[model samples]
Target: MTLALHRHGPDGVPLVLLHGFPLDARMWDDVVAELPGLPVVTVDAPGFGASPRPDDVARAVGRSAEPALETYADAVAAALHEAGVDRAVVAGLSMGGYAVLALAERHRGLLAGVGLLDTKATADDDAARANRLTVAAAAESAGAAAVAPMLTQVLGATTQAERPEVVERMRSWLAAAPPVGIAWAQRAMAARPDRLFTLEDLAVPALVLRGAEDGSAPQEAASTMSAALTDAEVVVVPRAGHMSAVEAPGPVAAALRGLYERCAQGSVG
Candidate 1:
């Protein structure tokens, strides 16, 4: 869907970074700044950041009945095509992780490696799905301000206590997000399928990372994903939460750099 992108670095295996739900590509600024001399791309998924809305995405995907995650993945593929990237190390955070799995399922050949950060491989339970719909309806009715509290829910206690500025930055980002976009994301995430099998069948190097204090993606979730992968490494970043890339950019970037090197060398196993 001609998604907006932030691109940098030279010719090589591109690293595509997907931000979490309700957040734009700017979330990767800290992490991107740490990695030098590597081709990188950060995308604004449909209905988020500067990208088009759900209607525009549906038109770009040429299917109205398809799942939103798959459509978002298609948009990523289109973005990669525009950038002349045939293969890449795709890394996603939270909702972005969900999109990464969908991309693997739909566009496996394009992935050189996969990075799943602070996300789960399971689908939403009945209650969680219902809650997401409820939140979506609220966003549609009341706008982004209504969902501002979600920032507190997702950020770790350490961040809230020691990194007030980061919390404020996140609040600003959430508050400025388009309400329609937020609602669309909620519905899309609610409808995402369980993707554990995708992890089990992963043919590329896989890295599963979670913030030690991340409530959204707990340790157990990371273990489950690790167990399913044939070649996977599980890492827990201390003093971080759902937004590990933001809270612990150094460690997160280090892990990503290692993954990229491993993928580039074809030495994942």
Candidate 2:
């Protein structure tokens, strides 16, 4: 199934924003607002936001032993083609980052640059994989609401303590997420391949960003990824967490603007 695409701006190297698991295109609302006239495309990966669910997605891509991340990358590539964008600077947060890496691996020619935000290149460890599977089972059996407790772990301490509105907004998104989508994402993430080699071989300009307080993708992970990329800039947003784009839109937008300009100037691969 064709994923839903939210288009913005025009006439430049396209900036494709991919949101993290259980969230949708709306997660980029504030950052997009800050970007103003820069060309941007935010996508709802399969089973999230306005896009088709996992069953439809599985059918659309046909049966395969490939991980779902590759399927997601293909959907994004198709969406861009339909939008008349031949190449784009792809940026993603968390699960979105995994998809971006997958895109780089399978559809390298379509990328102009990459933004890895609050994510890592390492595959899940055994314990982490088991935990993800457990979460998937819980989400399947009890619905999306069963994953609400993740808010505490995903957000920064400051966001949890002071940003009631942000917390509520995130909660709403998580609560409304499809159970099937959550389960599918968890399983896919658990099974994701380690892509550190992809980063090491990257030819395009890349940005590695993370919230200073991000537990999911720590500062060390950002540094490691930055070290791997041939050309990369690292940005750590203070007072933020896993959802740095939401927690610190100003810094995230500024960083994105820099990446966009680099891509537009033909400096990026």
Worst 10 residues of 2 by lDDT: 58-67
Q: Candidate 2: what lDDT?
A: 0.87
User: Model 1: number of clashes?
Assistant: 0
Q: For candidate 1, which ten residues in a row score worst on lDDT?
A: 58-67
TM-score of 2: 0.95
In candidate 2, clashing pairs total 0
lDDT of 1 by residue, 1-269 (tens): 46887887777778899999789999999999999998889999888888888778768767584337888888888878877887899999999999999998999888999999999999999998998898888988889876788897778899999999899999998889888788888889999999989887888888899999999888998999989998898889998999999988999999999889889889421
Instruction: Give the alpha carbon lDDT tens digit for every residue of 106-193 in model 2.
Output: 8899899999999999999999999888988898889997688889878899898889999999998888988878888888899889
Best by TM-score: 1
Candidate 2 positional error at 262, Å: 1.3
Structural similarity to truth (TM-score) of each candidate:
0.96, 0.95
The prediction achieving the highest lDDT against the true structure is 1
